[model samples]
Target: MKVIADENLALTDYFFADLAEIDYRAGRGIQAEDLTAANALLVRSVTKVTPALLEGSAVEFVGSATIGTDHIDLAGLATNHVEVTHAPGCNAQAVAEYVVTAILTLQPERVQAGTDFCLGIVGLGNVGSRLAQLAQRLGWRVIGTDPNVQLPEIENLSFAQLLAESDAISIHVPLTHTGQHATYHLFNTQTFEQMKPACLLINSARGEVVSEQALLNDIAKTQRPVVLDVFEHEPIISRNLLDHLALATPHIAGYSLEGKARGTQMVYQAFCQHFKREASKQFESQLADMPVLFNLKQPLSTQLLPLLPQLYNIRADDQALRAGLNKDGMVDAAHFDYLRKTYPLRREWAAYGDQSF
Candidate 1:
């Protein structure tokens, strides 16, 4: 068997080499011609897999080693008789930590423990729900909005209510273009105007969830601090947006080593199941010595601001993105991809559990 896979999928060969010969390719540049001899395909979000993309190819199974499916045309792939599966919640911890780190960086004043600061979560899926749990545990009043999902503990608010009431809003919805609650450009001018004054805005979800021009205008008008890990025109993002953002990253919010390894493990199991082969139950990256930078003897709420930075200095990510883009003021796709590809994978908070304080 032959497999076409994304070079970025961690442990792609370690897991699949025994099963098939792998043809690794850059995700964004993967094309139909590469699938001619492939029995299975593995991808990250950058590659768009439609039935059209699979036409005349002998590919059967396709797996995305990421949580979201917006980039994949599910119905189309199924209609073409292709077995499709994705690793949902694989990077939930990574993304949740990213949001928490951003919040502490942007508005640490609002997140003191046992506090009543309102945090509005716009989705209740894997990533959003995990974020809500983290924020609530940190003593923030967490409210969520997802018409199709209801977390009994989290007060369900309408999208409008979330906008009007939240002290800081973190977007986690998928980029949908249809349905009653289509999220495409969901945070446009009208919605932005409805938001609480000086409310922090975060979009680690998808770029199209907020209209770029509308966001640019809103930033100018309200001077609201914003954190964006994803951009509408990603890779070719707006430098103006970069200038105004409180924190910006090259869509590496979910790029943790553990997360990537989990995603790869999930897809490998799925591949084994589909092909009727036995799968290994134990999987994950080996551990390293994770040192706690500060004494955690104090109340965590009082020190989250400083503690999280020591664990993962989010500003370093912001500066790196800005440094590359600020050089020529031109859209550099290669540089953007380079940042993600060469990103030194950060370990989640779980890794620090065994650390000697």
Candidate 2:
């Protein structure tokens, strides 16, 4: 058996040599010619697995180590009899942590006073649900908007109601067709116009789910501020939006160490199931520890941002990408892979303890 693994995937070395002859390369610029003899191809979000890349290849199976599959050509893979799997909900906690931190940073005064504020979770999936729990724990009113979910007790509301009532909105929906009220450009001009002017928008979901130009226009037209962790064109963000937005990060909102390790173990389990092999004992035991929150007598208002990076350094990723602008496409691919494989230690909010400082 032969397998080609994207270099960006976490813990590639641990799983690569176990099953088959492995060919590892950076995800971008990977052509079909490279996998002509491969039975399986593993990748992250950076690689686009289209028909053009698989038509002439001997590849039969595809695996992605991330949640979003917008970059994968699912229809083409199915037509070609190529099986594919993705690690869904693998980074839910990481994204939830980011949302909580952003809420604290954006509205420190409200958080300090424990004043109630509306948090509209646009999608009540894994990440959104986790975030709602955190918001509720912090004494915030949580309103969810997911047309797909049919729960009797959870307060489900219309998208317009969420927009008008929420003081802050966080998106966590997938990008799909419109039949199920798909999330592609879900927050466009009309939706933005309907939002409260004082609203703070956070997009950790797919980029196209929120229109870039429309967000920019809305920010210019109103007091609505945004904190974007995903952009319409990744690795190439809009300059105008960056300058105006309160927070702009590379797509690392869910790239915490715990998240990446969970993704790695999930794929490993999937691979084990495929071969009918007993899952590794170490794999089951290697779960990352949750964050610890330090209880303070007084709310640490001034120490929030400075202390946050200790748990998850948001700015380090920003600076790292900014430093690598001059690299070629292949170099860019290598850099991205390096960042993921050598990802820094990221802990959840609960990981910080009294001794954290």
Candidate 3:
């Protein structure tokens, strides 16, 4: 069977080796003609899979190698008999690590042990659950606010309570428009006003989850630090918000090599299950040739905070975005997309977990 895939997807060769023909194209630039003759199509969040894109196509299956399915029109695909699949929880660890990095970047003093430092997780799904575990391990009290999910040890509070108590807040929910608990514009002026003045907000979930205009106005009044890895209209982001943010990245919180590879494998297996074909288990890559050693003079107990920078410095990513601004002093759409396409290889934190301090 012929398969058309996103060129930016990692390890495409390992999964599509047995296919008749594997056509790779830019995700946002993929045309309807590209899918008109293909049997299957694989894409990332950048591609918008709608009825308009598949109206006259022979595409029977559509797969996205990403955790969120907001970009895919599930109802439309189901009505047209086009099976859809997505990779959920594949990048949970990567995003969790990114949250930890963001927290440390925003407030290093809060990284110390104690219940005084509390972390509020918006959604207790895959990414948020992992982050809660990490923060708990680092000696922070974790309070989650997902009505549907409840953990034994973690305290599940209401949104208002979470805003009032949490020293730092990280959003991990999906972007739902019509649901009773809609996440779109969840963090508006009132929500921002309710948060503690020093509360640090980190959003790695979805851009539209928080209202950019509201946030821009709210931050001016509250002086709250906001870190965003996703935007509402990606590639076409607001310069006012970008300039106001304490930390900003080009939506790459889950771009770790292992996370992306697992995403590709999950979608490929889903495609195989749809076609009743044997899936390959050759998901391997040479992204990391050698171990990244971190040498510190302090005790291992006091080394975690200092060694985190060796693993990944989020400031570099923030700087890259600041440097890619357009001539008009706004973020360039092409430059934003270019940063993601040519992102540096980042291995998950688990890669160096076995190393001695």
Q: How many clashes does each candidate structure show, in the order listed?
A: 0, 5, 0
lDDT of each: 0.85, 0.74, 0.85
Per-residue CA lDDT of candidate 2, range 1-357, in tens? 888888766665666567778888878767888988988888888889988898778887788889878889999889998878888888898898788777766666656444368888998877888777666656677888888774343468998999999888999998876675877889999999898998999998988888888888898889577888777876564445566778766677897666776676777677767757676634324545555555655344434545775666565665565454443321153454466556664765545553211
Candidate 3 residues 219-249, lDDT tens each? 8887889999998777776667777999999
Off by over 4 Å in 1: 292-299, 326-328, 354-357
Question: In angstroms, how far off is 259's CA in candidate 3?
Answer: 0.6
Off by over 4 Å in 2: 113-115, 150-154, 281-309, 318-345, 350-357
lDDT of 2 at 162: 90
Estimate TM-scores for all models.
0.94, 0.86, 0.94
Worst lDDT run of 10 residues, candidate 2, spans 325-334
Q: Flag clash pairs in model 3.
A: none
Q: Mind giving the per-residue lDDT tens digits that candidate 1 earns over 97-173?
A: 89888887776676663546888999999888888877866778899899889998788998888898988898888
Q: Which residue pairs come into collision in candidate 2?
A: 291-350, 291-351, 292-350, 292-351, 292-352
| Model 3, C-alpha of 350: deviation from truth (Å) | 1.0
